[model samples]
Target: MKSFGQIIKANSVGKVVDFDAGVDRLLPFDFTATNTELTAAMLDDTELFSDWINKQLANNNARYGVGGYNEHRTIYSRSAHFDTSEEPRRLHLGIDIWGPAGTPVYNFYDATVHSFANNDNFGDYGATIILKYEIAGYVFHALYGHLSLASLSGLAENKFIPAASQIGALGPKEENGGWPPHLHFQIIEDMHGLKGDYPGVCRFSEGDRYLANCPDPNVILQFDF
Candidate 1:
């Protein structure tokens, strides 16, 4: 297999970042970010450019991809918190880059539309797209959940995803299940051939299995932030 070091970048320093700062940037959320030394501008979010990640989750939503190590673990998983609704909450499988709607999203590598569907639910990913690809002989897949309706209009399975292709735009809160606009990206080694649906969120009991198979999307994204 090829080393993901070649496919992804750390934090948000990628082609998509140029389109909008909100799209990607290495936040001081990780230990390395703090080690790099945070600037006054990085601490201020009034401009809406700084990352809102913290030990305490904002608006009862799960905390993901933030902490002292920049490792995976949710606010609910932390012992200091008092919320019981989200048990086994140890962060998330994907990095959530909060931003505005209509933010352009693209394919990280060449892939084919494995499956897709409009998951309409209160806390569900509004619209999702699953793409399959191969890297250095490793067959794998990526899921882009919580996309906008416009992103899925007229889309079909088996569609082509050339490397660096623009697949769709991010959805707003209203259209994307009332959360801040962000892309829920997850990597899959084995799709099990399921189509139009897969579990982006699962019970804590299955966390280990998912984490092992999922690995770090940043492995390909190269976004260490």
Candidate 2:
């Protein structure tokens, strides 16, 4: 059997977020501890963090700020939701597309709605959608998080969504777990019997296992920029 990443690379996928990588510039953002620009105060204040994101895009002449896959992000310190007695989950497992709220997110392949929910926890994926895809005898899933609550209003499980169809819109800070507007996109080889949500971050020690289950989304994103 072909590997999950290989299967994704073999198939044709659509843009999860509408943008022409060839025409529009995408900024690679760094939320790791090395980025001195992300001060503690700035990370705690959503408005300040958002302003900083916009500034980065504006200065770089980019349409959207992207990145965070397998990143050891310090920004999670602002929220206790990621904390535990043993260790905090600081390693990001998804690619974030930082842009304005209400930005449309599309399904990259033909799929059925696996599950949907409003997580509502601080630093959580406020409105989440998980889609199931079966390609070349391999079954896997994709997760879309930080979505507007309205996106879940009429959605139902097992709803057939055609490729390139709009799935939902990015939510504002007030709705998207109180962070800057962005779409959290992740590709999962297995759902682990979980629905509507999965670990988008994990402890640094668990990075290997989590990363294996969650492949690099760029294989499907195909962002040339």
Q: Positional deviation of 147 in candidate 2, in angstroms?
A: 0.7
In candidate 1 the C-alpha lDDT for residue 89 amounts to 38
Clashes of 1: 17
Output the number of the lDDT-best candidate: 2
Using all chains and alpha carbons, the TM-scores for the candidates as numbered come to 0.66, 0.97
List model 2 lDDT by residue over 67-141, tens digit each.
Answer: 999999999999999996578999999999999999999998899999999988989999999999998888889
Off by over 4 Å in 1: 1-24, 28-91
Q: What is the C-alpha lDDT profile of model 1 across 155-220, one tens digit per residue?
A: 778888676767787787566654446677777777776776665544466678766667677565
TM-score of 2: 0.97
Measured on C-alpha atoms, candidate 1 has an lDDT of 0.57
Residue pairs with backbone overlap in model 2: none
